[model samples]
Target: MLKIYRNTSIFIFLVIIGVQWGFYKNYTSEFPNFIGKTNIIHIHGALLMSWLVLLIVQPLLIKTGRTQLHRTIGKVSYVLGPLIIIFLFLIGKGSYWRAIGKVPEHDILRDMVLDSRGLISFAIFWALAMLYRKDAASHMRYMIATGILAIGPGVGRGLINSFGLGIGTALTVTDLIALAIVGFLLGYDIYKKKNYKPFLVVFIVFLIGAFLWQVRDSDTWQSFAKSYASMFY
Candidate 1:
């Protein structure tokens, strides 16, 4: 189970990197623009990548019977997790400011709301994983849920750029991908442990969050988002 998740994390990390590269074209002519972003972008990217690398390493440590090392390294998330949330906010706010007139109002609202939900989900799952640190099953499951939550933007971007899907369609596809992952986890729990409580909770949270994201462009949400953006921008 641990090995499966570890490998899955690796695959997700690769996918995220590929999506980022594709969307930003940072490796090509856009490298200067990408590297010249405000310090917040650099910090956010570094912390996020560090977290992903830690996720991949922690499981490998456990699989190799280096429990002590794993625990030691796991402590890093206490700092990295919060930093990730903070930087996510900063990045999102920066994006909102930059898109004020250039991007459509509906698209901006949708992105802000979806980004907020992802941040909330990450914080919740990270806290739960910490609280259940002693319970390997619950802890690992929460961690995996966090990973899934963190990948939404990447998945959405991949869908948009790779398939030429519209933002709305891409977001819907990402939501389905999240549902499928939770469904698989639920099935695994049912088959192996005869208990799916953890994944059930995750599924509910994910569904609600995705729904909120889908409706971000509603009149009520748009009003709120405008007010919120005004405060920051």
Candidate 2:
């Protein structure tokens, strides 16, 4: 099991950073002289990227037999985790508001569903990972799930920016990729006769999120979204 996770986080980190760099190549091209970049955006990027960095570092510490160092670094998530949730919500809300009138209402609402789903899924997985911190196997799996959730946005952006795919199609492709990854992990765990519940739960969440847009036309969702945004966003 440890071998299975040895470099998995590194692979996830690279994929996430690669997709994000490709997707936002234009913005990143500006480099140190990033004009028009807001502080919120900077903070948001820092928070998320830091979490990914931690994921990479933590596994390495363990692999090096530095268990104490790994535990110390893991504690950083106590502060980092909540900051991530807050900023992710802020960034998503900011984008939604900024897109008003500029982007179509249907598209905006659909995007919101996908964004909120990812946010909810990340929070759930993170919480579970922390809750199961004593159980190394479960804890690592849930943490991996959170990393998998982060991939969706980067992949969506990559699909759109690299291939000029429409937002809907890009998002759909991202969902498919995420589901496939989780499905493969779940199958592997089952085959090994290991506990598969964690991956199974994450797979269900992603599946629901993939098909969630089908309910965007319902009045209840629209009303709730607007109300929630008005209060929190």
Candidate that would win on TM-score: 2
lDDT (C-alpha) at residue 37 in model 1: 76
Give the per-residue lDDT of model 2 (tens digit) for 13-98: 77677657554765667778887777787898788778887888888778878999899889999999998888778878887888
Error of 2 at 167 (Å): 0.8
Question: Which 10 consecutive residues of model 1 have the lowest summed lDDT?
Answer: 21-30
Q: For this target, which candidate reaches the highest lDDT against the unseen true structure?
A: 2
Report how far residue 139 has shifted in candidate 1, in Å: 1.0
TM-score of 1: 0.87
CA lDDT of each prediction against the hidden true structure:
0.78, 0.81
User: What is the lDDT, from 0 to 100, of the residue 217 in candidate 1?
Assistant: 72
Candidate 1 C-alpha lDDT tens digits along 9-118: 68657756754655554323356566557888877777876877787778888877899999999999899989988888888888887888999987897778876777
Off by over 4 Å in 1: 5-29, 32-36, 104-106, 230-233
Give the RMSD in angstroms, all C-alphas superposed, for model 2.
2.0
